[model samples]
Target: MDTTLLHQYQLVLSSREALLNYCETIRPEHLAQPIPSYNNDSMGSLMRHVANTYLGWLLNFLQQEQHPYFTEDNHKNLPAIRSMFEQVNLVVNNFLQQYKDDLTAPLNLPREGETKLTLTPLELFTHVITHEYHHKGQLANMSRQLGYIPVDTDVIRD
Candidate 1:
């Protein structure tokens, strides 16, 4: 593996593990409960979005096609959300393995539409990291709004 890319992978993994640790601390019922008066983002909802993004960016548009969306029923359950998290790891790990040699190869993304943007594998991978962190912040805030102390996870722990 490329050492640089490997470092990125570890960072993503560390951050994700940190997130799961926090999620595990919440009671199952609280995991899915909407943060009252917050932006309607439950931890469950943000996680679903993050999980679905792995499928979309790496598995679908970047690597291969996957069902574009998870069924709505899949949302708002801790176990189900956790399953998605694992699935995200699977797809992303597979992607990096398959494309390690082509990190700079350019490709178009989203769809064959006029508005689609082009980026190399490395850039897309970086985008996924930043995007995950962006929503991770929201998840942390959601937990805080619901009265759970926020956990430090937005940065690489090691």
Candidate 2:
């Protein structure tokens, strides 16, 4: 694998692991505590959404294997959320490995309306990485608001 692509995938995987570790520190009861000003998505829901984003994008957009995204409330609990993140990490990790050499191959994906967008595997993979990193920022903020410190998910850290 190219160093750059491997690094990108590593950051995504590490981000998921960081989130799982963060979940371990949270009180189960506080999993669903929502910051009203932030939005209706609680910590648990946000975690679930992050996992679902990986599944849905890979499946529906990137032509990967089909699997149901665990978006229901029951699957958004602390333990389940952690598991969902693992599942997502596994799928994406596999996808990245299997498609490493095809990174620049354009994908035939559709847009929301009648438009079409062709993206390289590299772009799709990057979207999944950036998407998780984006949520990790929100998760960090949410953690601080809830009186807990989120794991440092920065790709480069001491």
lDDT agreement with native, every candidate: 0.77, 0.75
Lowest-sum lDDT 10-residue window in model 2: 71-80
Q: Write the per-residue lDDT of candidate 1 for residues 1-158, one digit (tens) a residue.
A: 56677677777788788888888888877877877665665678777877787788887777657666765566667678767777777777877887788888878775665787789989878888788988888888788777789777855453
- Backbone clashes counted, model 1: 0
| lDDT for each residue of candidate 2 in 46-124, tens digit (9 for 90 to 100) | 8777778878888766774568768666454667776776677677777778777778887778766867788887887
Error of 1 at 3 (Å): 3.9
Inter-residue clash pairs, candidate 1: none
Q: What lDDT does candidate 2 reach at residue 150? A: 71
